[model samples]
Structures are given as structure tokens and as C-alpha cells.
Target: MPQGPGYATDLADRYDDWFAPPAATTDATVALLARLAGSAPDGPLLELGIGTGRVALPLAARGHDVHGIDASTTMVERLRAKPGGEKLTVSIGDFAEVDHEGEFAVAYVAGGTFFELRTQQAQLRCFAQAARRLLPGGLFVLDAHLPEALAAHAGAGAQTVETANGDPVLRVRRLRPAGQRYTSDYLVFADGLFRHVRVDFRYASPGELDLMAAAAGLRLRERFGGWSGTPFSDTSGYHVSVYELPA
Candidate 1:
């Protein structure tokens, strides 16, 4: 109903094989989240756009109660098939508007998934929903690419071909500054045919996202260049921002 996941179905099954980050990156991300979330006794955690439980699974393994919302059943199925995935609760729908019961101590949208909303209004709604699902003093963490990087490439498209799993994959992307959005297409050759996936996204700067969080009655806590707690700077390529609901 919500256009069936921001990710292309063809890519869902092999998402990890094609795009999984290095183990060190995943471990760092999980570590930061665990530090921010504190102990398992605080409360359950929620992940928006869980996407095969890349971040969620590890957190769950650490003894944190984790729940998730995802639009792709195929992707969730992949998560469910993995160890410990079947025990977690997951809701299937547009994460911005879907309702999940109860509040959480920590809620996060990682891996630049916030951009998938494709509209400022929708992104704002997502902030509101995240706020609604958080308890007082709860934290909402967002990881996204810095908009300036995309702005530098605005008004033109780029293409590149790389080999993944012994297959040639062509990637193309176009950025439109007018709407602050971008579209990317990935074509992977398999058995002499092309497996295509397209993604459309709207991006906002850290300042813009701060304004959205304020509108949702959340306040900025901290922002870092990455999961390792590097200080945010003008040249930082991405950010991991933490917003908190008032106690």
C-alpha cells in the first residue's frame, strides 16, 4: 500500500550479500547504540526500517528487547530466517504512519534510511511518530548522509560500474536540488540478464532535521560524524544525531 518498501523487491533477498557493511562498521554501530540505550532493563528498543535486522539483531543479542517496522515482507522474511530473528516483533507498513503499541527507551533509524521518506512532510511525520513512540527521556537516533555531499553533485547525474560477487553492477544517480531529492538505480548482471533496483529519496541537512525534531517536541542531544563519536564538522560526510524527548 505504501508503494511496497522503498527498496526494490529484486534486491531484497540479496541485500546483505550485495550491500552489507564491513563487520567493523556493524560492530561500531551496535556499540554506539548500546551505549546510548544503556541497559536492557530501561525499556524495549524500536528500529525503523530494520532491513534484515542488520543493527537490530546484534542489539537483541546483547539482551536489549528489540522490535522493528519495515515495509518489505521479503526483507523481513530474510530477517526471520536468521538466528534470533523469529523471536522479535515486526510490523509491516510505511514506518512513518504505521502504529506500534507502547513506548520505547530508544528508537533509531540507521543506515541513511531516513531519506526514504521522499518528502519533507513525510519525514516530519516520521519524527512525530518516533516521538510518540518514545517515553519521556527517550532518545531517537538518526544516521544519515550529509546533504552537502549530494548538493555538490546537484544538476547532474553520475554512473559507475563495479563488480560485486563476480557480477558487473552499474549504478546511476541523479540529484535534484529543487526538491532536495535524488534517485538512484542499480543494475546487476546475472545469468546474462539485468537485475534492476531503483530508490528515490528526499534528504535534509542536520539543521533541517533539527528543526523537524523541534516541531515534534524533541530536542537535540548530540551529533557525531560517525558511530565512533567523532566530532561533527563541516566536512563530515555523514552524521549520527541523537534527539531526546523531555523528561
Candidate 2:
């Protein structure tokens, strides 16, 4: 199993401010996820890398019972400080090997966090764990970057992240295709602070992820370019894939 990425102390403090999406985007994400999850009577939801409760908190607010497993206590601490965050049942550990007392209606890993496992074997284990956590016929949702899209800008690039009220922040990234990994650094000019966040990904293609899910007894149900049901295409940058366990 993979070890920890220490976000609690370093990145946890600045994560929400630096990476939080606009309220509209967040609402869309939560809406799509909640819909895919179906009714709450199906089962509680499980978030594999529920960071700072960005998505999880809203789902909880919508009256879904949310359980999460994460490697960073600092991240979980920030989550616990938020409203409704305290009510969540969270475990501090490797999500790839995480277990729960009961099955869930949905098991999801959002924002490309699944790629952080860094090895195909580890990613496979994560799929297996997710399968085990979900009830039969339940869904396992993944939001991941398209390998083709990342290949489009394999070497280096910069992106602008701005909220309606906040100044623009620059994000720089470099992809090393040899190992199928990348690193990102954030330049927050508004705060006059330079925060560097490095994420390494084994970067699997959609087919590879599907095979892993199959090995874990899950099958693809739907795939889209975005949360609003955009058709997946070669030019799309990211994908939201939904997989289902057999009934």
C-alpha cells in the first residue's frame, strides 16, 4: 500500500482558499453526485479522499449520511471544523485499504485524487476497496484527468484560477511521461505567498481504470466529459466516470 501525503500540516491550511471551486461549480458537482448516488435510502455515501469536506460537507448538508477515509489528519481536522463536518464518520488511514462497518450507496474519489496512488497495483487495491464498501448495484464514481489531455501539454504549462471576488492565481505544471507522473506548483499573487503543491500520478487511461474496476467486480455505467453530462471525446480534458457493482 502507498504511504501518506502529508497535506494536513502544509497544504491543508491553504487548500480551501487556494483550490476551492466557485459556488456554482461546487453545486453542480454535488448535484450530479447526489443524483448518481440515487436516494439516501439506498445507503450512505463513502468518499475515498474527502479533503476538507469540499464535496462531502454539501452532500451531508443535503441530508445524506457521509463517511470518509483520508490519510491526512490535518485535512480531516479542517473538515471537522466546518459546519456538519463534525457529524461525518471519518477514518484516518490509507483509503486503498480502508474498510467500513456497512456498505454504501456510492463510493467516490473526486478531483483526480485517485491518481495519487502512484502505482497500478495500489490503484487496483483502491478499486477493490471501493467495491467492498459499496452495496450491490451501488455506484463508484471517479473524476480523473484524461491521459490524452495531459499528453497534449506533457512538458509544462500554466493555468489561471480565480474566484469572482479574488485575484487570479497562477498554477504551473510539468508532466514527465516516462513515469506517467506530474508535479504542480501554485503561485498565489493575491496573498503575496508562493505555495508549492506536488502531486504524483500513475496516470491511467480510462480503459485501464475500467479494467481495474472490472477486476474488482464493478462495471462502467456511464462516463461524461464533465458533471453536466458533456459527451466524452478525445479533446476533453477530464472525465467523470461512473461504475456500478452487480446486483
Candidate 3:
């Protein structure tokens, strides 16, 4: 099992309030996912790291049977408490290694969570697992930021993001190019208290990810700069990539 404190059980209570919020980009992402799912041939949809049902809930509401896997039990419990969350079948375990019964029409990981695997080998395992769980010609999608863009922030940096009520949260980050990793420490002050959180990510180039997919028996199908079907180019800062298993 993958061991980590970054996504521990304690973080579940604040996970949604801290990260899940409706935005124009969020709408676009769901729209794109729903569109891609429409091509699937009647099977359950699988979400890797389905935190608090942010995307899964909305997709389930659209009449799709959605299942998910996450390492954090607390997060899954919180998801179960939501109004439509109970409709989702979630297993609490590391998505990269967990085995869920039944083949799926589509499997996806959003918010660059794929990088949370920490190592290239782990990521490969995740791809292989997704391919195993998907039916032939089934889709495997990923949403991630381009690592090339992080070159602009090669050193230490800090940014302050405010909440809906104007409460400020400061994020301090550092980049290590040699390891292709980024570390972030967040200081949040809300409800008259302060909380600290830290997260680490290992990013990979698009080509590297494509190679991993190929090793997992998946073939690249589509690549977009954004969820709106924007063409991917050298200037693109993020990507929504789709792959398919051989039929």
C-alpha cells in the first residue's frame, strides 16, 4: 500500500471546502467528461481518486453509474454523506493498486492527481491497472498541467488565494527540476484558527506519459489543451488527454 500523510484521513473534513468549488473551468471540465462518456458503450464509469465526489457526483446525477477508489477513508465517508454521494460505489484504497470488480466503459483521473503516485513506476502500475479494468475500446482520460510551464517558476515562490469570504490562504512552493517534483506548503487561517498542510507532486512530460500508456496496452486517442476541445500545442499550459484500449 502507498503510505503518505499528504492525503490522510484528517484532511477529509476540509477537503471540499478547501478545493471543491464551482467555476467556469469546472463546468467546462464536467461538460467535456460527459461528452466523452457519451461514446462509452453502457458500463459503469470509474474515477481514480474520486475526492468527495466532486466530479463523480455530477456525472452520477447525469444518469451514469459511477464508482471510485481513494486512499483516504475519511474522504470516502465524507463523499457518502453528500446528498447524491451515496449513489456512488467507492472503495477505500490506493487507486494505483486497488482492484475493483467489473469492467468499466470509462476510467479517469482529474486535477493532476495522477502525479500523486510519486514515482514513474507507480504511475505505470496505475495505467496498467486502469487498462485492466476497462473494456476493449474503453476510454482512459487524464487532466493534468503541463510540466514545461513550471519551468517559469524554477525557484521558491508564494501566492495568496482568498476564499469566498475573503479569508486569505498562503501557499509556499518550491520546484526541483532534477527530480521533476514540486512541493507546496499551505497556511490557511479561517474560523479564527490556523492550519498547515503540505503536498508533493512528481510531474511527467506528455511524451513520458504517452509512453507509459503504450506500455499499459493503451493507445492515444485525443489530446486537448483544455476541456473545451482546444487544440494542444507547444503553447498549451495544461492538457486533457484521452486513450483507448484495443478493441
Per-prediction TM-score: 0.91, 0.91, 0.93
- lDDT score for residue 65 of model 1: 93
Q: Point to the candidate with the largest lDDT.
A: 1
Candidate 3 lDDT for residue 241:
93
In Å, residue 4's CA in model 2 sits off its true spot by: 4.4
Off by over 4 Å in 1: 6-8, 39-41, 153-168
> Relative to the unseen true structure, what is the C-alpha lDDT of residue 213 in candidate 3, on a scale of 0 to 100?
98
Worst 10 residues of 2 by lDDT: 1-10
Model 3, runs deviating above 4 Å: 3-8, 153-156, 162-166
Error of 1 at 147 (Å): 1.6
Q: What lDDT does each candidate get? A: 0.83, 0.81, 0.82
Residue 117 error for model 1, in Å? Answer: 0.3
Which 10-residue window in model 3 sums to the lowest lDDT? 1-10
* Model 2 lDDT per residue over 184-215, tens place: 66676556766555555778889999999999
Q: Score candidate 2 by TM-score against the native.
A: 0.91
RMSD of each: 2.4, 2.1, 1.9
Tell me the tens digit of each residue's lDDT in model 1 across 39-119: 322889999889889899999999989999988888889899999999999998888874788789999998778999988
List the pairs of residues colliding in candidate 3.
Answer: none
